[model samples]
Target: MEAGEPTSLQIEKQSLHDQVASRIRDLIIEGHLEPGSRIDEAKLVEQLGVSRTPFREALRTLAAEGLIVIRPARGSMVRKLSRADVFSMLEVLAEMERLAGRTACERASDSEIAHARDLHERMLEYYRSGERMPYYKLNQEFHTFIASLSRNETLCEIQGNIMARLKRIRFIGNSEPEHWRAAVDDHEEMMDALAARDGQRLGDIMAHHLSETWQRVKNVI
Candidate 1:
């Protein structure tokens, strides 16, 4: 390698820790790392090709996020979710989303609302095309655009955390055609409420919409 040139190996190593952390987080969120399963740090370190420092750092980060529990002797384990945990999280997210939706109804400019409508239409087209991946991506974008329009940084952060935890369960629910259609309809209703600037109606709809989702996915979880 020439001077000032970044060797492939050097670049890879520099970002290896972040890569490892992201992979671990994905596994946890996807249920590949089951709740309460002991994380074998030694094996993970070997597999990730990083030293103890970065591996431990990743563990600490996850623990801080309430995704992992670090015990004195048992090392690290994935955090287990009880029914109460599920309900409590869903309730909190529902309220946060309601706040976002209400704020968006008041604060979103005409162009922003139109963009969301366009995304929704595109999402429906993707669904009709039977390409699940594209549909899911657009669905995420639709929700994210609404959240962005709320202009509440704190609410956006909270919604992101809630969505991350729910992603795995959402995948399961999306596998059912009935749930998929219902989810599309819900999005449409949400968009309608936002377009009308109906803050109270939007809040009610958002809360109920999330509640229904939790009801559908809780059994699978």
Candidate 2:
């Protein structure tokens, strides 16, 4: 092994911390630990069966991702967004998604598009069966995959960053049956335009879908 190289134990520990972060992230995104609510660090740590070290590390990671806010003396709390804040973020996200969809149509190969289609189909099944969490997870994955098809590193990075912050809001947006069905319909149109390689239409749908997302979730947030 080279000098300064991390041992297997080190690697395992890092992965453990990452896993803890994911667990906590899910807790926040699923509203188990709701927005603007202070985290009960001791209780959560014990409940998760993790040491304070890794738990605190996970919290710091979330803080960096804009999902949680950590104060100097006070404990951490889930980040809260105002209606206007959501609107502004969605506006930017819409533009990014618009560009990503258009570019993906022009750039993505057949196999790449097929893979995204597969994910969408899986998400659709979850929706059909009324499994909200899995459906929401796959929905986010599909959108993120579309952005990757553009093959623009910076665009994907920015989109993922913004998407992370809005995961909770977006997931709960589909709490109503009507809104959930509407979102599924948007994905259907998006996939159709993508398959046709109609960049213009795909871009338009992407932009409009995000705008509608704001409408669906604004009341809740």
Candidate 3:
């Protein structure tokens, strides 16, 4: 074995840590652990049947992801974005997606564009089945895929960082049937614009799509 190589047990421990983190992330995003609520670490550790080490490690992971705030003496609480913060972050996201839409139209290969179309199709199927979380998962993936199509690493990196904070906001935004339909409609048009290679049209649609999220989730905080 190479010096400094992690042993198999160490790998398993890291994997367990990541699984714990993912579970916690889903709890926050799905509203099971409401925003601004303090994380009852002892209770959760027992519930998850894991020890304190992994649970605390998971908290650190989520803190880095912007999903939770860890205070020196106050323990940790879910990071709740105020209405103003929501607006500000979504504004930046909207602008970035707008640029990505434009750039993707210019840069994405035909196969890549078709692949995005396929992802949208799968997401629509989940929507048809009325599966909210599955639909949102695909919805998130589709947006990230579009951003990656820009082929600009910096843009994708910045967008991802902002998105880590806004995950719950975006997830909850489509709680209503009307809001979900509106979002789907926007995506449908976005696909059309992309297929036509109409960067201007796609950019406008993407910007409007994110801007509408504010209306859907204004009261969450």
Per-residue alpha-carbon lDDT of model 2 for 1-221, expressed as tens digits? 22442222122344377878887887787777879999888877766677889889989999888999999899899999889889999999999999999999999999999998899899999999999989998888999999999999999999999998898988888999999999999999999999999999999999999999998888788
Instruction: Please give the lDDT score at residue 190 for candidate 3.
Output: 94
Q: Give lDDT tens digits, candidate 3, residues 45-109.
A: 75566788888998999999899999988899999888889999999999999999999999999
TM for candidate 2 is 0.91
| TM-score per model over all chains | 0.73, 0.91, 0.90
Task: Provide the RMSD of all predictions against the true structure, rounded to 1 decimal.
Answer: 7.3, 8.0, 7.8
Model 1, 19-65: lDDT tens per residue? 66666776675566777789888766755667888778888777766
lDDT of 2: 0.88
Which regions in candidate 2 have their CA more than 4 angstroms from the true location? 1-15
TM-score computed on alpha carbons, candidate 1: 0.73
Better of 1 and 3 by TM-score: 3
Q: Flag clash pairs in model 2.
A: none
